[model samples]
Target chain A: MKKLINQPEQIIDEMLDGIVSASPSSVRRLEDTTVLVRKDAPVDGKVALISGGGSGHEPAHAGYIGKGMLDGAVSGEVFTSPTPDQVLEAIKATDSGSGVLLVIKNYSGDVMNFDMAAELAEAEGIETAQVIVRDDIAVDDPENRRGVAGTIYVHKIAGAKAETGASLEEVQATAQKVIDNARTMGVALSPCIMPTSGEPGFELADDEIELGIGIHGEAGIEKRKQMTADEIAAELVERLLPEVDLADQDEVAVMVNGMGATPEMELHVFNRKVQDLLQEKGVKVYDTIVGNFMTSLEMAGCSLTLLKLDDELKELLDAPSHAAAFKK
Target chain B: MQLTVEDTIQWLKQFNDRLSEQKDYLSQLDRAIGDGDHGINMARGFQQVAEGLDGDFDEVSDVLKKTATTVMSKVGGASGPLYGTAFLKMSMECKGKDVDAAVLADMVEAALGGIKQRGKSEEGEKTMIDVWAPVLGTLQEEDFDAERLKQTAEEAMQKTEDMTATKGRASYFKEKSQGHLDPGAVSSYYLFAELADVIGKGA
Candidate 1:
């Protein structure tokens, strides 16, 4: 309740307006939809990369739109899936002559809505393809794993491909490759408050933490007595390593993401353990990104995303990108 | 006899009223295990549905579909989509027709299936499943009578008081969730009981 805002009802809309106001000249909002597209969209025949989901995971879909990332992003209400019409609006707004590639997270509603939108877009004579990012190894079902933080990588590589004038097929192919190689796992110490209610959705005692939590403050896979930073990182990496073949490889682009309430110092402390653990496992991490990339409103905790990389993924990852949340 | 749109709206109104009546009890159940907002959120959504009631729909499907959209927009968390999709599926099954006991049965089956598919929770996993499974089992075994369905659903919801939750936030309690009824099951039971009462009164 001690946050800065006029009213909870207008938070998303107001924040979006603020984002557009501050946004670079390269991005513009699609009419009558909450989608933000590249200023000169369609790039006149370049394949477009579009990704979106709920709005709370900010600087995600919208912030990633730029030269080497997404061509556009459709945003829904906070923690709510974008409507099919909203997504279709984005597709139509960004469709130039080349087809569009949609990078969707592996959540049920997101998949279904995007699927319906893709069908509608196809009906409108637009070619649309999708790559679902299910990089969260924390979820038990490989077939049904919820898409966690690894979606950021999809935006990066696919955006690079589209920016370089790759065909729609080629862009989707590259995104799928990243999906197959990357893995993420998260832990939360507390639940986030829905802005409207201003009451925490779920509660945890001071001495416990939930591992493998979702972004919307859904219950995690397990809860254990709170432990040290190193131990938490070890537990997270233990679950994450099994998804990708890290035994023979060394290079990685590590993202130690703080789940909102966690501070940068704590993230770095967590990162140190991650570095040590990878080094011990003979995994050579060539690049590291440790910060808040995706968050659960104001939940306290962090997640680790390891992208086991080859030369190609590493290059695309290191490529320059600009967004409200990310600039490098 | 087929159920009319007036009956459906009356059922929704009664559902909202009953939810308000049992809000404190349901919130207590949720307090013991899950987030203590099942009654509050359910009541909020149904209240919106009640407000959105513009006379009556031409068909029960139209009524359910409008309720679905209202729930989706008004409710948050898994309930919004789970309940919304359930109603959407139910409406699809009963489109363009009045709802008889058999139609009600089919709609329930479709809604249950939609909840299972969407939430992916299993029977023993303590969720709304704790109440839904028993009520569904009872409904499927017995012929659909409004009075009979009300009695059976009430009994099933009461049974949740002795059961342990295995899914959602309540699952974390492991054994503590035992002896406390699941709030989700309680809210669902109220919805069904209200529907039955409305239908019976109209009939």
Candidate 2:
């Protein structure tokens, strides 16, 4: 309710303008639409990478747009999927002769809207491919899991593959590989308030936390009494490591992502436990990222992502990225 | 009675008024199980439909087409495309054709089919299909009573209170989705109930 903004409706427009202004040399907002593309868009003969969803998951979809990451990202209303028209404009602005690859998170609205946009783009003779990321491990039904922080890993690896002049199909296949190998789990200590609604999505007792929370303010798979940082990290990592495809040889990249309001101090504490747990399980840790890669609007929590890596993935993950919010 | 374009506009205008008046209430229902945007999205989409209806339309199908595209473009959620596709299929089913009871039945059936295709859903999924399917059944019956139509929609909407949602954002809640009305069903009730009133007055 106490968000720093003028009007609820203008939040997206103002936010987009702020982003463009902050990084004018790197990005530009497509005119009259909620789409942001890299300044040198169409990057001439490279397969384009695009991803987007609701507005509150900051430094995602958009912040991931730059040199070796997303070519463009669309913004929907707060917690709402972007309309097909907005997505269509992004496809048009970013698709070069090499075609475009849409990296979509697995939410119903995002899937439907992006699917419609891809169809429209195809109708206009732009070859488009799509990869859906559904790496959240909270939901009991594997078919219905939401994509969480693991999506950025998709954007990173897929963008690297595309930068190598890979075909749209190749980029999409690589993105799918990341999707198949990565899994994430998150726990929220509190709920986030949408600007328009001015009300928290849910309320938790002071002593409680939500496990398996989605990026949106929706409730997680289960609620439990709040536990220590180590306990929470163990709970999240235990759920995630088993979901990875690491067989005999176990090397993985870890992302300890904050849910907007969580700070580095707490995230590192959680990260330490994640590493301890992974090491205890005899898993080789290649590289680790600890920061707010994806976030709900000011929600207090953190998500842990484990991406089981092979040589191809390791190489792609090591590729340099100049994406504004990407830490590397 | 042949439903004229004016009557269709009047029917929609009434529904729009209902949506504008109850936008917050509908959103309240959505807040419980879904993302709490159904009412706001529906109100925004129908407002454009209301504006789209202010001008001249050559046929009822044309009016339906305007509503479809406007809602599809303006409404940004699953409801937008679902409602937009439903109206579009209804319009296509009755192009240049008289809307007698049988034709109306066909239009509703087409709308239902479009909802299913676009949402990849079926009845008992706690979606708008739960209301639309039974309403179509009532329309196809020999005795097409308007009161029964309204009651059917009301009861259908009410029945969703106990149904576990298997689709849309509500599906994430699983069994917790029960005890709350599906916001789509509530809005679809307003849609059908308004049509029932127009038909009752032989509009």
Best by TM-score: 2
Best by lDDT: 2
The reply for model 1, stretches above 4 Å from the true place, is A30-33, A97-99, A116-127, A189-191, A224-226, A247-250, B16-48, B68-82, B92-96, B109-143, B155-187
Restricted to chain B, the TM-score per model reads 0.92, 0.98
| Model 2 alpha-carbon drift over 4 Å, by segment | none
Tens digits of per-residue lDDT, candidate 2, B83-147, equal 87889999999999877788888999999998898787889999889999999999999877888
lDDT of 2 at A218: 85
The local lDDT score (0 to 100) that residue A255 gets in candidate 2 is 94
Interface RMSD of each: 5.3, 1.2
Clash counts per candidate, in order, are 4, 0
Native contact fraction (fnat) of model 1? 0.03
What are the per-residue Cα lDDT tens digits for candidate 2 across A1-328?
5789998989999999999999999999999999999999989989999899889999887999998899999998888888888899999999888998988787778888888888889899988988888899887777877888999999999999999999888898999999999999999999999788787878899999998888889888789998999999888877777788678786899999999998789998889888999899898999999988899999999999999999999999999899999844
